[model samples]
Target: MRLDPPPTTPESEHRRRIGAVQEAMKREGFKLLIAYADCWRTANVRYFTDFRPVDGVHTIAQAVIALPAESDPTLFTGDGCLDYAASETAFDVAELEHLPLYLRRHLNADGRVALAGEEQIPVGLHRTIAEAIAPAPLVASNLLAKIKAVKSPWELEQLRHAAVLTDLGMEAVQQAVSTAGQVTERQLARAADVAMINAGADTPAYLSMVQAGPRSAFSLALPTNRVLERGDLVLTDIGARYGNYVADGGRGFVYGPPSGQAREIIDAAADAVEAGLAAARPGISAADLNGAIQAVLIERGYAEFSGEARGRGTGHGTGMDPEEELPWIGPTDHTVIEQGSVFTLKATINHPQVGGLRTERIVHLGATGLELLDTFPMRNFW
Candidate 1:
């Protein structure tokens, strides 16, 4: 089910992640874990063994994790799936049913068994794991989140790759504006997509937001077939994923020139992003962070925020999954901002007539300085 990976590539990161798992197992007395996902987002599966499941599907590259208290971990996945991935990365993979009997035999003889990440845990599979590793604590420590929130050096490098791709994607939009006579919003998005994919990225990161004209003035917009005019404002937010980790980047653009409400909202949104970033130190609370930017947003002559959600929670947890775990850029986060937490602050301002202004920045809470995941811009692209 598994094969030794090449000397470079994925193996080194896999080994480092697994070594962390072994230490956690010893400290916590966790015997084994069963991590299953279509995506390689499951840190346990990736850490315990180098078996990234078929991304975006559950049955493809799935894994059944087995680890004794202090032993090198093992993984059971689809035949040839692990081997194929291992050719690119390093991991210890095997083929075995995740039945109760098989798990009991593979797990530690006598110790506690803990679930690594229960949020992503499947309902039916929880029963399977419970039946197999019974009589132990079966703890829900969210250990994976704790381990992954902090960035490793290699992960930081890969994040830069994702960011660089996003930068290239933004450039595509600029190119379209400079040369094109007329193009649909969807077409503009496609151009950016093509550029990002061709820029050493596995995919186009994600759909570049190309809401044009009046349609560009809101949150949660789906792309449509509206074409650009000589003086159309467009919002293009795009991102890329490297090694299953996401680095989201976005920007606002004007095919001609921005004025009136469009100009005000764009400036306000960029300032708000800056305010939020300024307040995101290790000791500051998420509430304080929101307050810093919320004050700026209110000062910019926009309507006051009036929702329980707390300012769109611009920052979210980042890792293999779409959301790593939590985004506490509001008052909800009681957890102290740790020294190494990776969070994406997507602060933006929106106006009814003008388009939305947004910026995506990945920040690592460091002792003295924060390492940016990407440094594109919140300015007008064209």
Candidate 2:
């Protein structure tokens, strides 16, 4: 069987994006905006130019896209390989040194400029750019986050495709857990990794979190060499990336039979997730959504496991980067739900007696309702 390569964002879409940002700059009184990209945080650059910098563990590769108010955007990078990788993108490619010269050619030093994805831009590089383009105010802004939060139809298609690949990965993980009898956490993680790549994912969205037994309580714990045992709950939170878009989710499975408390928690999480989806429509506040999910969990006698009591919010935004843009679904976030927003809703709980359990789903807020993107079964207490 053959898998299609991840679809590229169309040239027209890129132009549309540039035009929108240019309009935004005109409104904000800025002449140029520089969007930075590094190994992990590539959404700002990729949002504008569809070029993601290749990165490795501890490797410091970087790229930047310069979007002027009324000129063609340009791509600046460290070396030839980055240039080669960006050949098909709509921007003109150049070495990082050329940035100062390009800014000189494109805008006057007195022109107002801004930096997008400032956190992703290294301090030294920013100092150099500021020094080279002296007298131009370089303000930092999250303009891309504002613009990219609303999904273009092209982005939605890419996200939908990514979700399919994620479903494949999750399916493989569940199968390995059910049939492998006894396996190491790494074995289950590898099963998911191989399945997603074979199904056309650029990479696993994050290193698959395969925590067995009590270790499942720790969300940030990596897969260890310990073997999964029967009667233990195995928590698997994994997904795949497609064309830089992510499909992030997870589910819990029991290697053997689950205890009554385990079943109750799983059922409560499922109900809360459904309540979240029900509340996730245009015009609702992020707080409203959070409150709705919290209500469900509280109603189910898990009030201590609801909201901040459980250690994390109900969910966060998802897109080109897994944590792309945000209006966190928590008690305090007042960001309104808007049409075309893509995000995830998660129901999670951890107790000293019952261990940890979670279920996640990706969704896009359409004109009518939430378009559930993740099709993998929510195998509660599997």
- The per-prediction CA RMSD against the true structure, in angstroms, equals 4.7, 2.4
lDDT of 2 at 186: 89
Predicted candidate 2 versus true structure: per-residue lDDT over 200-263, tens digit per residue: 8888988888888888766557899889776666778888898768888878777778888777
lDDT of candidate 2?
Answer: 0.79
Q: Of the candidates shown, which would achieve the greatest TM-score relative to the real structure?
A: 2
Residue 212 alpha-carbon offset, candidate 1, angstroms: 2.2
Q: What tens-digit string does per-residue lDDT give for candidate 1 at 1-382?
A: 1112112335666667667766876777666644444453555565444346765444454566665555666666666475665563443556545456667777554657767657666677778777777665577766656677777766666666776777777777788778888778887788778877776666654555778777766654767888777556676678765555566666776667667666666677777778778777868766676677667776766644212124556576665554566546665566666676777766565556555656667677777856676666676746
Residue 112, candidate 2: how far off, in angstroms? Answer: 2.8
Error (Å) of candidate 2 at residue 203 is 2.1
Q: Find the 10 residues in a row with the least total lDDT in model 2.
A: 303-312
Summing lDDT over every window of 10 consecutive residues in candidate 1, give the lowest-scoring window. Answer: 1-10
